[model samples]
Target: MASNPPAPEAPYAPVQPPTDTFGYGGYRTDEGPWEEWNPTAESIRPVRGKHRVAKQRGGGFARSSTVLGVGVIAAVSAGGMASANTGKAPVSISMPDLPGVGSLISDDKPAPEAASALASFGSEAAVAVDADADADQSVADAGEALRSRIMAQAESQKTQVEVKAAAAAAKAKADAVVKAEKEAEAKAAAAKKKAAEEAAAKVEAARLAELAKQYTLPTSSYTITSTFGQAGSLWSSGYHTGLDFAAPTGTLIKAVHSGTVTEAGWAGAYGYRTILTLDDGTELWFCHQSSISVSVGQKVATGDVIGRVGATGNVTGAHLHLEVHANGNAEGIDPAAWLRSKGLNP
Candidate 1:
């Protein structure tokens, strides 16, 4: 039958497993690594239709593996870069409040590109903090300037008030001085008035004293025959009640002191009489006249004629009777003593 296949070649040479002898493990040659064995169409038969076709055409499991590996590496690199950029916390910053910043930050509305550029460069909280810091600094500087101005104004006002107070105090002191001076002037005027009154009183006293010195008795300088207090009865009643002057009748009579003659008329027991009264309280009576020459209330001087010497009715031998009374009372004292009391010699 086809020569019977050359006697079947030793029972198909007893098929054996492949072995590795070189370090490449591609072939089992003992001297060195050999080329890896690849089967050709001339050596092997083709596989079944679709599975074999998929291997020769391009898109296979190997291409799918290469694409999946590249994608994995790219994703890993992107994630690592983002982590590096995001890890550092922002540096600390101080700021003042910005206009509309709080609204822009707290609300969901987005700002314009100009605004958002500044806004997004920092965190929303960081934006608020920067704006607030700048605003706070500006406000503090403005406040300091305003405070300085206010303090300066207050100091100026205080100085003005002090000046006004000083002026007022000076005015008050001047007014007080003027008032004191006026009071002193008034006191001086009162003192002068009082001194004038006292001086006038002294002058009046001196005038009254001088008038009493120059009066004498109204007779021929008669000697004392019967004094004012001789207590013996000579003719009538109980006592010699009249001062007797043993003078001739019709002797010219004179006034004793400057006075007014109250009466020059007839009397029953003392015939004719003249009554005279002087200022400052002294009374004189010339009794037993030969004739009457004066009437009531006739003014007379120290040496003027009032009436003649009298020796009528109850008189002995043409003698004159004289009487002196104090304050219209008939009480008697020594006539010579009373005349001396008036600074007059009888």
Candidate 2:
């Protein structure tokens, strides 16, 4: 038989529970070297696969999901930043469809190389953003300049229009003034012409009145029976050669002007007639007289009674036939005209 195992020790040792070095129970009277050491990542080693981190119930899975979600959010935010840097609209990022939830939480740590690449990308994106901003500012400045130019041109045009309007108004005002002045001048000239015409008329009237003062009619109450040059068969001449003044049978006839009696006789056609010669060599013949009052060769004043009118030879009524011989012409002139020449209207 195999040697029997050494005799078992006697059961005198007391049984003891497991000792706890981690101090979970509470205080420790003595401090260890581990307490003096400040643990750094370089000094500490990560737990191997054999060791596992302990967690509360249901906490480990939730923490892993949260970390995964944060990583996805960071990636999407980086993409948005890239779009903004490129001056493009931001695009929505969707999570890739993974076959299992484990894929989302598989790796929590990022690689060193990827982190360096993200840093470089961020620097380039910043440069892109600055360039975009500069371009945008340039465009805005150009637009502002264009707007300013348009405003300036509009202002210039408005000023020109105003100037033209002002000039036109001034010209119209000046024209109105000129027109008023011309109208006033025309009215003044017309008034002056009328006044001159009236003055001339007054002077002519005065002259005619003075001329009329020197003239008178032959007899006061006599009526004109016939004018000179009247066509009649009663006279020896075909036309009457004297003016006939009808009166009563015993009416006095007067000398028309200051003259000398040239003849007082009964001619064939004139019975008991008289003739007078004026200082101007004009002869006056008074026929159809009833009787003669002045003798021949007698000097007589104007208006002296020379004869009385009666129905004498070749006369149909009591009247005086007066004839005027201008400058001793045989053909007798019209007595009416001769009287008018001496300012007497027959």
Candidate 3:
């Protein structure tokens, strides 16, 4: 772009001052004449690019340029006066004092004193802000620490509870195992004892069966008229002392076991009697016989005919009275029980 040349300086020309309405000149006092001036484009032109503001340093309003620094100080002074009028504390601002600038703002205080007061006020504000920041940081740190401590304590308590629960569960399981083992042992012992008892009973039954083949009844086809220990007035003793087998007269009587005939003779109440003594000294007595077949001291076998059934010598009927005396005792035992001991039913 082409630049235009600067306009020449206008000539100094003078004009008469104007009157209000009647062409009368305005009154002039002091020792000077009234002069007239007319504004032109060149006289009222705005200056450009002549004064440049220096860049500010350290974010402060103070500047190296005297013209710019004076404007900033004037604005701060106006703002302070406005705050004071509004009943609020005046804001303090720090700035470098420009030479001859303080005379334009405040004539009462020197520029250095005003600059010092502003710097002191700014320092105090900075200190207060730093203190507040430090206090907030401390509060934040304390809160974080407390939260961490609370979390740790809660975690520890939870861990302890979990451990205790696990321990209790383990103990219950162990106790259950012990109880089950004890119950199993008891069942096994009971089964063993039952098996042993059954075996013993089987052995006893087999022994009794073998003894059945060795013994026999004394007589056949005969009815038992009376048993041992029968209470009656027909006998001399208070109770019947023998087992009576009733049959027709002359019915043969057999020996109960292998024994020697100890005696065969007529007694007071026994018509014909025979006594058999075994090797073990167990005596068998046969009374009320019609005839005696075995002689005295005769070794007779089991099932041999020893006497005959007869009703004689205080007998109620034809019957054979049999008695058993162990070890040759005079008192006889129950003949039926003695026969059962030898594995005979009667």
Off by over 4 Å in 1: 1-213
41-159, model 2: which lDDT tens digit per residue? 47546546875544423223433433445455544434444444455655544555422222332345545544443344446556656767888999999999999999999999999
> Candidate 3's residue-wise lDDT over 1-346, tens digit each?
9899999977432233334312235645442322332333454355478675544434233324334545655455445444544545655555555544454355355567555644554565566567678889999999999999999999999999999999999999999999999999999999999999899878866765676665567787899889999998988898899998888998888888888999998987977889999989999989988989989989988788998888877797898899999998999999999887666776
Off by over 4 Å in 2: 1-208
Please estimate how well model 2 matches the true structure, expressed as its whole-model Cα lDDT: 0.71
Candidate 2 backbone collisions, by pair: none
Reference-based lDDT, residue 333, model 1: 49
Task: Flag the better candidate by TM-score, 1 or 3.
Answer: 3
On TM-score, the stronger of 2 and 3 is: 3
TM-score of each: 0.37, 0.43, 0.49
lDDT of 1 by residue, 35-101 (tens): 2233234643544565522231222333333333334333333343333445533232222344333
What's the count of clashing pairs in each model shown?
14, 0, 0
